[model samples]
Target chain A: MNRVNIVGIIVLIAIAIASPIIAGSFFAPPPAFIGPEFLVQIVAWGLIIGCIYVLLASGLNLIFGVMKVVNFSHGEFMILGGYVSYWVSILVGLDPYLSIFVSMVVIGLVGVLTERVCFRRVLGTSKLNEIILSLGLIYVLQNAMAISWTDKPIQIRSPFEFVTVSFGVVRMGLDWLIVIGVTVLIMAGFYILIKRTEVGRAMRATSQNRSAAMLMGINVERMDMFSFGLGTALAATAGTLLAILAPITPQAGAIPALKAFTIIVLGGLGSTIGAVVGGLVYGLVENSTIVLLGATWKDAIAFAILILVLIIRPTGLFGEKEA
Target chain B: MNILSDLRKGLKTPKIYLPILLLLVCLLIPLFGISPYFIHVLAVTFFYISYSSSWNLLAYSGQASFGHAAFLGIGGYVTTIFTIQTSIPWLGLLLGALVSAFAGILVGLTCVRLREWFLALVTLGFSIIMVALTIELHWLTGGVYGLAVPSLLPSVNHYYYGMLALTVFLVFIIYLITKSKIGLAFVAIRENESEAKATGIDVTKYKLLAFTMSAFFAGLIGAFYAHFISYINYQIFHLDYSFWPIIISVIGGIATIEGPIIGSSLMFCIIEFLRVIRPLVETIDPVIKLNYPKIQVLLMGIILVVVVIKMPKGISPWLRKYLISISK
Candidate 1:
């Protein structure tokens, strides 16, 4: 939108492209160029990880856009979804994949309840109140899950465990394929829901202008609940995917939640497309940083990018509203 | 001349002496020969009062930082590292605060232009980055095992007295700041940044000043905490450290001098009370015992929700209202 922003974006793109090459040349293996395979592996892993982030960040962006509330506890909902799927899979002896839908539905209902009980009262109040309230919810949800399930990290056993598919030089697990496919399908369905359905129109209308939407006779309250629930359901789906991909713990949501926050901020606060792009960039940056600077720098690099983006463009890449 | 007049006016208010009286009572607690454990809790409570007060200072300026533990951890680690390398405890403490102030300025530079949720997220990011760095640079920080720092002074009674003195000094300074023109700028910025800017207040400068001062005090408390606990670790940057001050500030009163002091004391007592009752609760119902942590968290959550919904002004202001009504 402005000269400074365009220049900043170009500079960042140049750095992102050049860093690996520079690092690879200096820190490459003795054979040299073998590092390319490692780079490929990192990229593949980054894409899979980014897919989960897309879901998580999109949900957060959706809620913020529609309700104008930042749900700091969204990660807890994701973890809750993971736990639900885990329990359902274990008790009902269903596949983890199938249990994802069940977890999404359950968590969606929980989100609706959360909206009505915790957030609804503070809907149009001070931003600080919403933050504090979400924090309180974080404590309640994380501790409650910890109490019921214990704090030990547990992995949901997928039916496709031990199955890996290799495409040329790239190898990935079958579960990852399904996870990516499902994420895309869910995102596509969400896009359709927002673009085609009457409820979707209401949500977009409210997000654009709440007062105008209300004047148009839209049931803004119901739309608020619906959008919150839908956003949470998306987070739940990401959680289920995470449960299958990695170990799930009550505290597992904290870091990813923070990462999702960074993604939304980087992608622009209330943009779905920005969330997707930001999530992918975050994933790539995180994984590549690991390759360049070791595993310890993975989390730090994501935040570093976030800070850089904020400094250059305070409203974020796609953010239209000024803070 | 203005300072003397302000002091005189402050002294004219009878209510102003309440905290002084309370501080005297706290100082006199060890004279009764209290248990070492009680003294430890009291000292930690005082430390939290200082810490929460520092947090309130920034919030008073209309900036709510969620990553305050970054300064706390920085203070702890910097002091511990300095003392470990040089073996000069006093210099280490001062250096720790200075280093934390420096870090705060860096963070504030990135955050001064942001507002509300964006600011909160950036601070949170910095805290997380600090923790990651602490762990990554394990050779210096001793990694997850943590490092032990020398005690600030011998005995729990000494810690109690030291913390009490520190709390009093810092709260007084904060009170002075809040009453000054700088404090007016902070309030103006928080109330309405655009209007404050329109009035030529240089909102960024005051906000950054609030950030620096708050971090300096938070670091001081953290340095004291490290010595008091005799252990410093990356875990100091955990969400618990950040949340404790917020919960206390909300419970006591936000943006008030006495709020953090009251909130810290009450919350510490509640936590200690729960700990003391754990065995009794276990004997009565073993199932509940297993869920004790969850129950405590649930209660805190419920309290936060209820407070935000019902008494958003918090306990201190609420108490003042009741007192005024009863007097009438």
Candidate 2:
């Protein structure tokens, strides 16, 4: 195995072995695996957030792959989705779970509009122009949301709030179960779309080489729009699930979005598998940091890891060597 | 010989007189008995001018920092904590700037090899990490509650003149650097790194110099502004602080000396004017009234978008083109 693989495996094994030893540090170690242990519960929470991060990272990777643009404003889409889902839940009286579709459709359209309006103008421009333009979009979208929602924290109640399932020491709400299931299904669907379908082949072609894809009857620009829309739709799905899981404010997406930047970097930019692995690792590290250090340090740890990762492996774990 | 020749050539230009003329006019504005609030508003413009220009210099040097607010926060916090211990305000400001510059060098070392997005992410992550660090070690820093900073300047007019002078000094030095050989190296690296490297420029050294200098000015500005406001907090490290310089630089013109100056003044004018007249705007309609604050910020976003799309180089060049055409 490669040194990196060996390192990852060792860390995973270390965590597995460390759990019993680390259990002493918890507020209360479970004498018998019953109701819900805080230690296990925190890890479960990490996994859920990690699952959400996976969705975000995948969407980002998909978009980056096709368009080769870093959308700093992707997190804003997630927040907008959450708001839309909230609106659907309140206005249409739809379940939060079902309202994910409504949000995806709504945010998906917005994403396409953003792709056509903002990103298209600056396509093939310098990387600086793309980044600066994304910053402006962030400013526009964030403030618009603040105007509509007034920065109040809102949560949509899931129908399965009371239902709980226990896996050994870890007990999770049924809603958590659904969030995990939704992410898996969505990811699987995305995998199928990219791996099985003609449209997916076209997208792959466009990402692989825009000029060649164009030569092969692919509308490269259309693929760009499709990838962007799909990426944003997935982000919205994560947002809806997160909003149901916890209270979400208009500005809440910024942190997670920034965290996703670190995830993409850790996984290597535009690498799907890297994003998944990086997301899970980041989420686990972040939650564990919260428990090990203090809550204040949680947000900072991901960034520290990002800088460390970049220093050690500038290309990231899964990224191809720089062109 | 080159320096002497360039200095002579620089002084002979008619463009040199414009800034002098403008400064003279600005110096007299407070003498006209404008409201102290108006002077404070103008001071804010000056503050942002220095702030945005710091980012502009780094951008000019081929690095774009998304977490420059980290340096700013570092300046503010170090100065605050230092002054609180020693009660030497000037020394605190100096230390704040210097500490941040040192920190900048450290960060620059790690990120000098990284490309644009990687650099941006690293810098941004650095800022986020700083926020966490400050909050985590709140015993000295006051954590989220934040400690009070000693107000450096005595009055509104003093702050106005003081900031104006700082802005002039900072911009002038930046202007001089951009004119020199070092600035040319920065430009070469920015345009095409391989070509710059082939031309025998030490890429890492120049990039580090840019990082150090950018961090110094940003830190200085951060401490000075925090002291002007008489407050310091972890919130000072927020994205808004980082984004302001970027937005202003982008709006005014990236990589140009005058771009940030023009941009910051123009943006702050719009922001302040909107804020000042928000009540009047609120009276226009119920929805408008309800969302006036949001609308104010939203307009900034829209303006930034329009500028990025319609005038990518920014308002400075756009305005210069119009002026040149009209004169012609």
Candidate 3:
């Protein structure tokens, strides 16, 4: 609130973020903190985590952008996608990679179905209705999946499990490379669709003003259902990517989905670059915190940052003031 | 004094007799020889009712907390630690309520200025932070394994009746607030903040009051919940605790007094009845140990979705409408 307070917080955050390197340097004999290899690994892991957040947050933001409806169950959609891909990979011997399309199509349909059945009714009444409705969806979807598939983690053994691609000091698994590549492709595809296509134009118009879009001969309700489906498809893609990267289970979606909310807020709404940048910052900071503090600090730290940002600058870093 | 007389004045209405009748029935249920398990479920439902009421009150001010478990856990841990240290459960509950009220004010100050979604995020974050804090201060609080909290009530019957009474009292107090000038200001703020500001109602003060009051009750019931379960742990901060109140509120109809009371009871009946049946099914055929908890909960979720679709305004309004029609 004051100049001193702002300066004090920045200093405090600096110490919290930098303390790990100092602690690592003094206490451990490995001298690994200053190593380029270690730095590269940190960067690589940050990029992977950040990319996942971007994909997931973008999906959430897409729906937020168009419908102004927040689907808290977006991550569950991803987990459902992950589960479908995991099973398809096992049953059909397809790579989780190829099976992502199956997940996308299936989950997209599921998303449309959910929107038609549940979210549509509560969409505009108030924010609380939509939030609670989504929360209910999480209970149903997560628990149903747990009952059907068992709560155990489902791992689709990667085809590139043992292979590492090296770039000088940076040696990372080929699977990680593929995950990042696919995320970028998805983002690019989404950008082109949003900016360069007819349906994309309709979506933008709807996002701008539902009544205005309706006046322009757009079927606004259809766009709501379409955007919901498309958004969940992106979320499903993130889920499949995560399954490829690590073993996932029914219980895995909540935290990451929550973090994606923080990503969109910090990234600022309706900006592609903002979401990407905010997500990567989140991923980097989250990784740093795990190293500096214990693993338990991860969600807490992100949330702390989110609260701080909301209090200090409610619109976020790149956000325009909402009309 | 004025508020108390106003509360008395409302009792002359025929509608007030329904809750009185319901409370009287609940009071007599234990004497009718229901199982301790059923009593336990009923007691837990009282906690949910309390939570949903508090949540609804906060929502009435236009702020919906997505992580009420933070305040709930705050009350649970503080009360547990205080009671254990000071050997006074009542003092502990009072102190816990005060502490949570203070927390409510802090969160309200930061959040009431921002978009509603940030309030949800901040509260959610606050709960996660509390979980971490409990673990980090494991020496005092007993960490994830949790502290064995002492129950003030002697038996399940005492617990059930005690919870029901406290829940009724808390709701009545909140109801009184909603009827007062403060409650008028809260509604004005909720309906339109700029208009409330334009009209010279201190929007921030009323919102903060609602938040603090809601937090106080949430923490009080949370303390009751810990004692009800006879244990305290970091798991108390789970998102389930946060989500349940929201679900209960919606199921009952948000921002309504009767909604949470009716919603929580119906919810517990459906979920717990299925849960209570699981062992019977398992006993009938040992080979069929159905995962009834998950399945039962899944059934509840489907029911919830259907309810949201069919009764989007929740069951309370429909009940009120039915009563009016029958009366006519």
lDDT of each: 0.86, 0.85, 0.83
Candidate 2 pairs with clashing backbones = none
User: What DockQ class does candidate 1 belong to?
Assistant: medium
Steric overlap count per candidate = 0, 0, 0
The per-residue C-alpha lDDT of model 1 at residue B287 equals 60
Error of 3 at B49 (Å): 1.4
TM-score against native, each model: 0.95, 0.94, 0.92
Taking the tens digit of each residue's C-alpha lDDT, what string does model 3 give over A46-159? Answer: 789888898899989989999888788988999999998888999999977999999999999999999888888888877766776787899999998887788888877888
How would you encode candidate 2's per-residue C-alpha lDDT over A1-102 as one tens digit per residue?
A: 356655654553354335433632553343443334776787788888899899998898899899999888989999899999999999999988889998
lDDT of 1 by residue, B1-328 (tens): 6767977897987666877789789879999988998888888888889999999999999999999999999999999999988888778778888899999999998899886888888888888889778887889999878898977697888888988999999999999899899999998998899999999999889899999999999998898889989998888998889888998898788889888987887778778889999988888876678888777877787787778766776799878887778767
Ranking of predictions according to TM-score:
1, 2, 3
Clashes of 1: 0
The per-model DockQ list reads: 0.64, 0.73, 0.54
Superior candidate under TM-score, 1 versus 3: 1
| lDDT of each residue in A1-323, candidate 1, tens digit only | 45644554455455555655565466543333446667688788888888989999999989999999989999999999999999999999998989989999999999999999878887767889888889888888888888888888998999999999998777889998999899899999999998899999999999999999999999999999999999999999999999999998898887788789888876667666768776776677776766766676667767777787789877776567656
